[model samples]
Target: MGDLAGRWRELNRAYWDERVPVHLGTAFYGMEGFRARPDSLKGFETAEMGDVRGRSLIHLQCHFGRDTLSWAARGARVTGLDFSPPAIEAASRLATELGLHARFLTSDVYDAVAAVEGEIFDIVYASFGALNWLPDITRWASVVAELLAPGGCLYLAEFHPFSFVLDDETGSRVTHDYFDEGPEASGGPGTYADEAAVTEHNDTVEWRHSLATVVSAIAGAGLRIRFLHEHDHTFYLQRQSLECHDGDIYRHPEGAPRYPLTYSIRAEKA
Candidate 1:
């Protein structure tokens, strides 16, 4: 990593490192509840992935391995990789307490191939809010491609980039450019788990990868896209006007503007 990438990683690692405890204790992650009944995967994503029973799966940028272990609960031999040591530690500890057969390791997404000892997985799964933290979409795609075995697939479920351009207050107005403009230094106080929590190491950086950019990057990484599906709903609150129904799904208010709030991509290695 160069100076700019190194700087971004340094800032982001510290920010995420500090938030592991917050997320683990908060209702957002619900560690106790998770241990009782472990399944954090989205229904649609589960459907797209079909059955992962006994298949090897690798989760990139896995924060504390909730979703990773969720897959393990479904019988996938799972491996989780994250840049934060505290997160990896927490994930490993949780897996031990839960007695799930899973592996948690600390590694930047860009170096996942070597970090995993060149192991290949049958399914490469990445979920919501994972992409924006990274600086390069293309390299990320390459890592995913390398992590997959022949005929294996990469399943990516992410928040739609379109919704990101609009103002966070309301999804109606475009407040930012849709194209990449380098990393945005929008670092501030509080983690997403608890927005008002007082904390140190507030500085961080993130990049926005448009729909086209994300799709093109995966295609360029030599994976054949199986399907790309956009949804009208999301799992988290991305805008003030969004409504939470069933306690897990978020959508536009009954009469509010309707747009793709989340999207999923399935690509296979030839």
Candidate 2:
């Protein structure tokens, strides 16, 4: 929103640019496996979204576009956007490789409406690892409001903020405050896609938007809350002891305790 924020976004952009090459090759993304089962969305996401045949869908912060192309595979006319140019470029190339007709654009989520040339969509979408990168949930929600046609919906699948407060390795206990809205800074060598893999740029800033904060922002932007669903599982290894199942979904190992690890919200423009 200001020069400082712009600089922070740049820092993140560089970090993400670094993750792209590593992500493409990693087993976490499972690019080769993605080809066989093109629609990589979780079971809950598909059920909540229902039949999207012919609906116009825009995926914000759509990394490399597997999920975006997955929507295309489901017959939604899809467009994907990300702040990182390299990510958008990869998405474009992937679309071509999949023989899927879709548009991929490079734009920060805050500037999404203008980036898309003022086009509106039937479904404005985003998922895990998206909301936290944004500094201002209110601004993000406003963009979602602007980009959706009347009666259009915003569907977000994201890691629960509560999950983040817990210890990183075991989900053992709270290691941070749930209410802290941070442009928290962290940096080093690797990414969530492959933690051990080496990389060039690692410094980045992130924010944690609590469930209430996110829902309220969307509501304040004039979107009606349709449903907010919390899940016991998440898509990635956010914690160390989590067990991976059915490809990418992760859960608390066997008989260990469980709490809300991920959530989805379906809100509509009134």
Candidate 3:
């Protein structure tokens, strides 16, 4: 397991390093608008996370730090972590360009405690397309608990595991296992940020973790679950078949049936 995890992390780092330039130029990440507005926070993040003013936040798997900077903009002292060096470089550049006092560290999330040198944060925020990359939610949860100061909380907004079972290609059929602990490997046609951007590097590995596993992991790490909220809409185009409604929000077309497209968990260390 240790050897597999190390190799998987290397593969994912290479994948994400190659992906950073693509994401930087893609309209999906909205780099231009982020420069103008400086707050790329989603409604659920604002609603569920409340004010981050004067808090210390560490964003695991931060993926170039747009969200991390967004939290900093709201007055949180922020640190962003990712395994990709190119991503950390880009994130640091963005922070300097925007005059935001944010730190970007390159480290696999499992090693986040050491990367931050045992520094405690008031909030540990992971969102959107994170968590699946981690093969062990139990260890991830422990890391989250380790990073937080006593009474500090974790806010995780992720795609629902149920949604992961559905075929994103068809958007109406079950294709993958919901409870599989795996090194689900695949080569991609293109990056999710820009489907048209041609890329030869597509090696990727992911795992499927159920909600029970996630919740139990957090609880076992000694964090009290504050709330769990599930949503029928996503802030990004998770599936090609999903329809865009208002803004960047996407959902199943009318009458196609609704399911929990996303879920949020707020857990606190006592």
* Candidate closest to the true structure, highest TM-score: 1
Looking at model 2, residue 65 earns an lDDT score of 94
**Candidate 2 clashing pairs, residues 3+ apart or interchain:** none
lDDT of 2 by residue, 1-270 (tens): 344455787788999988888899998888998877787888999999999999999999998999999999999999999988889999999888889999999988998999989999999999988888888899999999999999999999998999888898788888999998787776678877788988877777788888989999999999998999999998888888799998778899988989999999999997
Query: In order, what lDDT does every prediction score?
Result: 0.90, 0.90, 0.88
For model 3, the local distance difference test gives 0.88
Winner on TM-score between 1 and 2 is: 1
Q: Which residue pairs collide, candidate 1?
A: none
Listed in order, each prediction's TM-score against the native is 0.96, 0.94, 0.94
- Candidate 1: where is the Cα deviation over 4 Å? 1-6
Q: Higher-lDDT candidate among 1 and 3? A: 1
TM-score, structure 3 vs. true: 0.94
- Indicate the worst ten consecutive residues by lDDT in candidate 1: 1-10
Instruction: Count steric clashes of candidate 3.
Output: 0
| Per-residue lDDT of candidate 3, residues 1-270 (tens digit) | 445555777777778888899999998888999998888877887888888899999999999999999999999999999999999999999999999999999998999999999899999999887888887999999999999999999999998889878887768898877767676775486787898888766777888788899999999999999999999998777787889998789998888878898999999988
Error of 3 at 177 (Å): 2.4
Error of 3 at 84 (Å): 0.9
